[model samples]
Target: MRRVADHLDIPELERRFRTCPDAVEARHVQVIWLLAQGHTVGATSEVTAFGTRWIEQLLERYNASGPDALANGRRRNGLKPSLLTAEVLEVVRLRLADPPPDGGLWSSRKVADVIAAHLGLERVLPQRGWEALKALGWSLQRPRPRNPKSATAEEAQAFKKLADAVAEEAAAHPGVAVEVFCTDEHRLGLKPVLRSVWAPKGQRPTALGHHRFLWLYVTAFVGPATGETVWYLTDTVSKPLFADLLDAFAKAIGAGPDKRVVLLLDNAGWHTLPNLVVPAGLRLVYLPPYSPELQPAETLWTLVDEPIVNTFVPNLDRLINTITERCTNLTTRQPEISSRTNFAWWPANRVPS
Candidate 1:
């Protein structure tokens, strides 16, 4: 190949001709060019080495299709129509809307079987409901589980009462500037996800084992009224770390007793422990147990940690730095929640089973 380039002394021209020529005429032109350059058929075949018959047929095809045939041929393996038609789609829709005979969330395989039975399709054919939903532009997702140790009705009523009292207390005593803050920690693994590779048809791309340790801790503060957030990323979530964060916020608020910060955070043992000793201007208020939805900081974990941090971080330090940067950016960019609600939203509400 190297000698061929030097022999022809037209590397640029060869590249242009090969790339620009109509597919039909390209092979024929190349063969003629090689022959004219003082090369025998066998030698030219060795140099440009395309089949002689194929070269001739291409020349003929060029004469027939003009420049249009230069476009690549339509691939037979491209996406085809589903064997399951509109009728089958209707069956799937109906099955999904209604629960199975044995109540509870339908598993993917069970949903597939239900679809198969309704449309008389093979299980394998309906199993592809997984893909069909994507084709239909519906996100396939599972419901969150209800907490086993969830607050009882009486507990809920008590919380609601406390909430009202807290609101009224702050209202009557405007001197107490109350703010709810939720705090939590997150971890990151250090392994580069090899984005993606295009392979020859029917071949899977290779991958390396992911083994790396990257750790980080984030103390996030979210405003309940607006989903606005503030966060600090550090090497660990120790008492000193929490104390430092609290002290910073307390000093930032200054000498006004009216600027008292009431933190509505999780019941994480560290956050709740009395020995942790919250700063003077700041108070530690706990969110109802098992109620993550009420904590606006939970959004950060769902949105930031799972996708960007988990997938992209490759080394421990890089992971921590990425998280810190992202948290800082998000703190500035997050939109306020605007409306505040009394109770947390959950898909699985307490219902008689």
Candidate 2:
């Protein structure tokens, strides 16, 4: 048993342990506090969940420097010299701009090989390669899938045009409360939607699934600027149904000569203007073909599916009820919705006339 010096009395040590703001410092204080109470080093290790060797080192520091030494020392020590030099990092950055030699995605091993080749070494550790990537502020990310038919230049031009059109509408009806909204439909069914979740190292979590073709459609109208959403649940989607939804939505938002609305949506078959009954003061703007990514309402589907993902629904009614509840809750979370859907290029609310 190593004696804890009388630098801090037991009650003072207890107070420091309790009031310490830093978690690591609090833990170190706890070890010293326990030892001051006559607990052996092995006993203090068991209590703090710290190794005995670590407790011994901590005791040495505390006895020598008093309570001030309990703070985490690792943070004060600056980072060690990186293996990735400036020249090497530039080479890695340039190489990353193109596909790897194998015409596949770049990996740590490939980056290590690149580094090794540059340094004229036989090989470099993959761990060092990973560190190099971090030093360059690169992260592993799943790429967003894009439709090959979608034209980037066309999307940019279309967005600019839409912004202009919205501005024009606001200008035409000045001070009439013109609101920009994006609407989309999502299909949910009895089929399970599986997603990865954290579990213990060797244990895998399971979700019960019963795949069925029975479906329900959730139509959402979301304002990108304010995140105000109007949701309608229906069993089917058609021109007539969509028209009715438009009428209901118009009534809900009080869209008319007093308040104009510019609604953006995709070029779906049911969303066409022909034979479609668009309500008064509601102008429909179609997004460029094959560009669902441009639709703000498209971002709401993930939020709408949270309740039912990786879980089994016995029937359509249960699924509908679950989704309905989720949608109702989402209506209150405007800030979250706005943050997710408000793309930088999307026009701001209340555009100057």
Candidate 3:
């Protein structure tokens, strides 16, 4: 017989056993891995720091009932299973499984309400309600804006043509001869995010005792070929600040667009205004009206907003520094942005046949 250590395969064993809900639940799988390593149950238990009795019980149970039983038990003993057991989970599944009351898709709140009502819960306290649903893997999320102002067919085509032009031109240039920067601005509040909690059906939910609103603006640039990003953070996004941000972005890609620098930017008033000033090395191309998807930088901002800037920073200085540090770290980790080439400019009437 192969010795336990000789055949154990620790990495593979870890992968299999770690899938269990927790260390306690995974003990059986741990024993299996150890036993396969050629150790007796007592020895396996000793090495695993698990009790021999428990390991033996698991082994015996596995032999009698098989692998599935070892993972998910068929029964819970004694008390009757509450209707609320799968509780909000059933609510989500049923709602999604069928159409809503208005014969439309089920809304988040309605799903919450149905689950609470079905469990015969009078209050379905918001705190415990969200927790329960989350435990069952139900998350309340909102849809994002899509199909931006490409408000008109002509405008959408115009933006598409611009993006394709830049892409094609970069193909014509070789080895860092050109770079593309898809740029955009994101604004965030410095207040702690409001979290939904449970309360009695008719009772008002609790509110934060002290909360203040602050603002942050971020400018992000993305490289299209590789998904790399560079971001700048500021408190106020003024015209001059915008110009400064543009200069910084130009240096970021090693400037001198004589090599051709294409900037995929939005049609925000600042970008289009004839009065606004910017650096000479960079050239701007507009995204289709109402269209934000073409700008890869938006995806970068989503990551920043969701993970890095999700909560309030203490003060302006700390927030600014923190934002810069985080942006640098993210940019380092995602190095593909350096390769992004600018959009090639073409006349509005041009369309690829």
- Over 1-353, each residue of candidate 3 has an lDDT whose tens digit, in order, gives 32333233667666769886755557667787767666787788677787878777766665566555456343354333344466456655666667767787555455556766776776554444454455567666788656643556565555555556566556554443555557889876556544455668998655332245677888887765555676777777777778878888777776563455677788887777676666755667777677765565665654464433325456656656766776777777554443333223422211123
Estimate, for each residue in 272-347, the C-alpha lDDT of model 2 and write its tens digit: 9789999998999888878887788888888898898788789988988899999999999999999998888877
lDDT winner: 2
- Prediction RMSDs, each to the true structure: 14.8, 10.2, 15.2
Task: Report the lDDT tens digits of candidate 1 across residue range 1-353.
Answer: 11122223445335635775456345545654554455656666675667766545443454466434333454334554364467766676667787766887655567567667776766654346665454555675677775878665566545543354356546655645555444566554555444454679998766554666555667666555455566667766767667777777666545135554556667766666767867765656676788765655566664455335225445677666667677766666545332332226311111111
Candidate 2: 10-residue stretch with minimal lDDT: 74-83
Against the true structure, candidate 2 has what lDDT? 0.88
Which ranges in model 1 have alpha carbons more than 4 Å from their true place?
1-141, 152-158, 168-172, 191-209, 226-228, 253-256, 306-312, 336-353
- List the candidate numbers ranked by lDDT, top first: 2, 3, 1
- Between candidates 2 and 3, name the one with more favorable TM-score: 2
Q: Which stretch of 10 consecutive residues in model 1 shows the poorest summed lDDT?
A: 344-353
* Predicted model with the maximum TM-score: 2
Candidate 2 TM-score to native: 0.70
TM-score of every model?
0.49, 0.70, 0.47
